[model samples]
Target: MGGAFLAAAVLARLGGRIGLPTIPLFILAGILLGPHTPGVVLLSDPHDLEMLSALGLVLLLFYLGLEFHIDDLKAGGRKMAVAGGTYLALNVGAGLGFGFALGWGTSEALVLAGVLGISSSAIVTKVLVDTGRLGNPETKPILGIIVVEDIFLALYLAALQPILSGADSLSAAVMDGGKAFGFLLLLALAARFGTRVVGKLFNTKDDELLVISFLGAAVFVAGVSEWFGVADAIGAFMVGLMLGSTSSGARILKLVHPLRDAFGAIFFFGFGLSIDPGDLPSVVWPVLAAVAVTLVMNVLAGLGAARVYGFGAGPAANIATTLLARGEFALILATMAAGAGLDERLSPFIAGYVLVLAVLGPLAAGRSAWLARVLPGGAGVCAGRGAGRGGGLTFRRRVRVRGGWSRSSPRPWVVVRLRAGGRFSRSSPRP
Candidate 1:
């Protein structure tokens, strides 16, 4: 495992150089070294790695949940509601219609649609960080949409599980869904009022205890969520959401970040272990088709949704690119369907499609200035940084402003900031 992690880091740099997402490179490295490939450095026991990967998923979702407060959801207002609703409807309808056109059965079509209906919160959040868009104005609504989508996963899986699994009755499905909904409600309530409980449980001064308590709680809730027939990621997310409301949440997040990155990289490697190189050739065309279709739909849905919420051209483009990533949850759906014996081709198609998007999404988002130049009024789009007195950095001009000791001029000038990732390091006075 240690060796695998080291290998991931080296490849991560390579990926960065080539403008690809780190997660895909990690997975690709895993594929090259996995058992299915030539006699290589495959883990003797893949099961342990699988478990670690599962933990990685939990951490990934947990961290994402930690980024938002429950109050964000409550205060989202009608624009959030309308935007989320429109986004979901467009994506879901497109996916379903696409599946039906391909001559799939009802269950198969539903699974495919569900796969396409939601974007990857885990991957998308990573994109936000990678592109330095976390502080962008559009980020709030992006996170809001992700929260809403995660909630939809519950209702969606609940309604569809019985049909796909051939369960006994509708009541069973309804019960399953209720469990998920009820779980969400419980978590929401905890998010709003459970800070007191959290304070008592985890000490801010004790970093060790804080780490242990946070991990223990996340893993425990994730397991419980699985037991309740929802995705374990949701459970881990619940723990994160609740903690995010507390005073110590930021501290916890800081403490847990290293662990999150390590385990998260391992998680993607494990996903690579599941794919077979042999399936690649057989599935390439469908994968290409899926990618092409989702690319168009993702951009449209993201832009349209952002526009509905009164966002401008720059923010709308950010939303569009941010939503481009599709991983984790889509893979989960494919894995579940494969276990239920849906169709052999289905899994490979998903794997290939995801592999493509996972790589392409980040590439697009990081280079969204290219996107901006194409959109109307986007040529002037600039992301602002919070500095003293609301100053913003832009690509207008740079001057080597000097400070102090100028005999000719008593008044001195100061260098305000440097640029990074197409945004200003800090806002400065307009010259």
Candidate 2:
């Protein structure tokens, strides 16, 4: 285990150094040390490590919430609703159709669709942020759609276990639904009130105390959610999201980042460790088919969303193409499937599918800008009014520059000082 951790860390660093997502490398490290590969024994049984992987997800989502507002969903209300709803419909329909065609049982088919319906917000968001695509005009709708999908995915994961596990009926589902809503309300109240109290109490510089408080809040909520039969990761995410709204969320994020990264690395590594090579032959074709279906459908569905939202074809295509990767939700599905005995035939496939998406998702996000450029009016779409492009110099600025004033700032010192054809320099005060 120690050696495996060391190897995973080294490989992840190497992967980052070479501009690859470190996640796949960690997964690869686990695969190398797993039962499938020869002469390595980092993990004897991956099921034991699954819980921590989940905790890592909680932290990952928690930090994600720190980047946006809960109300942001409402801000993109009409467009997101149309896009998000359509995206879900297409993906879910595709999952069911593909699964049934593949001859999976009803329960198994639903699991397949649910699993494939989920895109990895973590993986996709990471790639966008890493490649600096988050600020792109196309990136906003893509991310907005993801934000909506994530909300649905969270509810789906919580409700899925009971439905698929055959542990409860529709009444249980209703109860679970109620529990979920209640849970969110409680979280909102906490975010509204608890953060201030907790933040003040932990304002001291005791690193250990701060860490403990943070973990304590995370664990407590996670536990409470579980007691109500909700997914622990969702609970953890809510805890983070709520606390993220607080002023201290920034400080907490910095302190927790290293820990989150370390555990997150192990989480992906453990996913690789869970793969049983013995089952690969039986699972490979199905896994590949599922991955193909998911990637293609997600993109198309995203494009449909773009059209409905009134984005030009080029931007829509870019947004759709950018959102075609999967991650956290897939893993959540696998975990639920495992608990429900769905793992008997599908766990390996889920693991492999996630690994593939982890690699491919980033590449897509990195190249989305290039792809957008080639689409009709792509470059100009990001230039004009209401395009959501950041830092574009306006025509007013050009007029100001031609007239020897500044369009953006009124400060005389900051005014344009043009010297050559369209070239400018910093203004200065001199004798």
Q: Kindly list the per-residue Cα lDDT of model 2 for residues 1-431, writing each as its tens digit.
A: 46667988899788878766566687789888887788867677887687777677666655555555455544676877778788888888898888788775777788878767767765654555455444344555666666567557556756676777676677777777777767766865675566667567657577788788888878778778767655565567667766666667777878888877777777777777876666667678887888788767866775676677665544565565556666666766777777777647777777777777777766665445444454554664332212222222222132333444444555433433321122344444321
TM-score of 1: 0.86
Cα RMSD (Å) per model? 6.6, 6.8
Candidate-wise lDDT, in order: 0.74, 0.65
Q: What TM-score does each of the candidates earn?
A: 0.86, 0.77
Candidate 1: 10-residue stretch with minimal lDDT? 384-393
Model 1's C-alpha root-mean-square deviation from the true structure amounts to 6.6
| Best model per lDDT | 1
